[model samples]
Target: MQSFLSKIKDFNNKHRKIAPFIIWIEIILIFLASIMKNICRHYKILLAVVVVLIVIGISARHLASVESKTPEEGSVVAASEEMSVVEEALQEATVEASNEASGEESLINVDSAVSETSMENVDSAVSETSLENADAAASLESTASLYVDSGISEFIKAHTEAVGWIKFEDDLISYPIMQAEDNSKYAIEDADGNDSETGAIFLDYRSSADFSDSNTIIYGHNMRDRSMFGALKNYKEDLGFLDDHKYFQIITPEGSGRYMLFAFMDVPKNSYIYDVCGDNTSRMREFLDTIEYKTYIDTGIEPTVDDKIITLSTCTQKDDLFFVMFAVKVDD
Candidate 1:
């Protein structure tokens, strides 16, 4: 009996890590059964009760472990609700800002109307008034661009490896594009070096950080959550999605610019479009021609060899297939 109890104790200790509470409950029930057998005449009843308790305890533990591993439906709903609340708040704030801007513009127009009347009264002022208004509008646009660049610079200061920010007009593709010594650094890791399935959008390892390359390549994961570059698949579902979202913006420390999307295609994993350094004007034109041919829809925007281009690539439904979108930088 001593030898048998010793072996049972060893077994319990070995499996304690896997199910601590269940092991402890089994031990207590067995001890109680042993005591009940000693006190009562019937040992079979106590033995059966202990066996039932052990089975129930083990089954409950197994169920609990499975539940812990699976994601809860309620949690997903809560997250989506929070995101909707945030988006709604942002939309309301944007509408308020637009109303305020309209109010300011109306006041400016009133001032301009009074000034025009004065200019009409004075023939000398009429000659230079239109030019002055043009100059002021240009200055305002320049100042706004400068302010946006400054904000991006401030963001880069906090995240040194961040090369630039990219955002598609009507998609959830807004993310900071990062580059490291190797492309694999951000392939499975975020900007903060945390392991993530949907990693940060990253520039190609061979591409320049300053966006000086002929064809800059950016990559992101096509997450099932519709995050990262997952929304890119919408183009395949609705061809008009491309027509509605023709432009994406990239803001660098140097300046901010827009890119007009001209083509989207699915290519093999080893396609030449992944080549960053081997591109020349002739090669780029050939590459553009191939993209134009493979594109699902003709955007009617053609690119010249001199224009700088960007390619956003992500995996498609197949592991070996890659979906890529090509766009040319629009001259500011």
Candidate 2:
């Protein structure tokens, strides 16, 4: 030991500059080894906390992004503008009717020239009102068409898997629905294929992409942040909620249509309702009966075997339970 210590001191004295660097390297290695030992001892709990923080942070950031992009006030303004146009047309019609009534009352005593002038005024008002109403209708039609084409096209451009948009009336269930090669693709990924705990609303891998199937099934995560399909659980809380929000819209590239809520229930994760390709009418009816039996609310709208239906499903708090909403497509 004395001989080894003497050699080490002799080497340090000889290579002073390089020796200090070697000493620092040894010290760093020892410090890093100590840290590694501590980390290994408490890794499980630390990992859980880190995962939780990451999820919360990601959820917070995603929600903020969604809020920033949503044009709540803009939609209100546009709706108000549409209402104002209609109201103005109605008010003008009322005024013109009053003028006509006054003109008719005076016709018994007025001269021919005055009568002719009043008739001309009334005709002009009618024509002007007609033109305004026509213009307003055209404007509304154009806006709707633009929304159908441009909005869907833009969404498709963002994510090729995005087949359409689904929205529940008076709820936060509005989201773009995507379809991938497999259902698992979007389970942990968003529509853009980005990692997200709040996965994209997705059509069942076995379902028809055009929603032409007898029963189409869609899935989403029940994120704690009230995003994705989290608000769907609200239906189970209040039967009146189902009544108030009895319908939802599913907009596709081909056209826009609506679905009326018929039933919502919770079932085992492997319930037969997930079978999108089943075509047996009697079996389908039996399945529908089971769903209605388990429903939280009675929508009074029973679906026949020939009727097309859609089911929106998500996981519940129970590991084995899943919540589902069933609706039938209504003619627009």
Candidate 3:
């Protein structure tokens, strides 16, 4: 008996991450077993039916979570391929910036040369300049090209509703974000346009699709299988989780936004926190004050009206309860 107990302890220690799930399953089984032994024999069949239904529910939830782990059936390219494309886009931007800088230098040199030339030779010096150089100077208006993430581009090709991608560094919160005419569509539909209870992470319809608004709000299901925004609860459960995991990235065609978690809290479904995309500075200040007041933990970082805010919202266990995670664009 001592050796058997030691083995069980060792197993629990080795699988500490899933120990809670294992313990819950064990508790349910033990309770069911005890009831089976004590309940009248006439009710045994009914209990068996209930057990089967519970198992089916658990299985279905697990299956749905696993299915959303990857992008819809070939909708997204492989990681390596996506990385190469990003690298290429970055290289192109760098080269363009360098070339534009060079063009400006050339124009400066030409102007100086013309200035030094005698008045009689001024027209000839300007005329001698190549048409290509003139065009390059005019084209210097834009030094950088807009880079869209290859993954986002591919997903958009498959489904036009795909607007951007959201990822939490060193976490399981990476997914393509979807948008529709209304927020209700993606709430019940997957990125691939299939119906799913664990719907795709999506931006609020009222907010700008490019994330140009003063405040952008995103929504995802607080799934039981830890998919979508399910893990966001950790911020409220353990404030220490924010020490290392406070930063997340919002990748868009305009640019990639690096945001730092500032606050998280549970609020009513119709909380003023949902009043996003406002341009009023005084109202924004009031919004910031309200956020500071309602947040569960103090991260010591306060966002100003000038800084763009992003909110990740999910439903809690209660119908009227909602959990929200707020972040500021630290990269800007």
* Model 1, span 1-332: residue lDDT tens: 99999999999888878786877899999999988778697677788999999999999999999989977899988887768646534533443354355532111123333111121111111111123333432343344345344577865777789888886765346777889888777776666576544557889878888887789899877643446676676776667877678788888888777888888888888887676442344578787788778888887888877788999988753446788888899954
Identify the runs in model 2 with alpha carbons over 4 angstroms from their true place.
Answer: 1-149, 276-282
lDDT of 2 by residue, 8-41 (tens): 9998788987977888999999999999999999
TM-score against truth, every candidate: 0.54, 0.54, 0.54
Give the alpha carbon lDDT tens digit for every residue of 1-332 in model 3. 99999999998789999978989999999999888776766587788999999999999999999888967655555665557535534533443454355542111123333122111221111111223432332232121012132445655666688888887876447777888888778766667776554567888888888787778899887753455676786776667988989888888656688999899888888787687553433567887888999888888898888889898988764457888888998884
- The weakest ten consecutive residues by lDDT in model 2 span 120-129
Question: Each candidate's lDDT (Cα)?
Answer: 0.68, 0.69, 0.68
Q: After superposition, how far is residue 96 of candidate 1 from its true place, in Å?
A: 40
lDDT, candidate 1, equals: 0.68
Candidate 1 error regions (>4 Å)? 1-150, 276-282
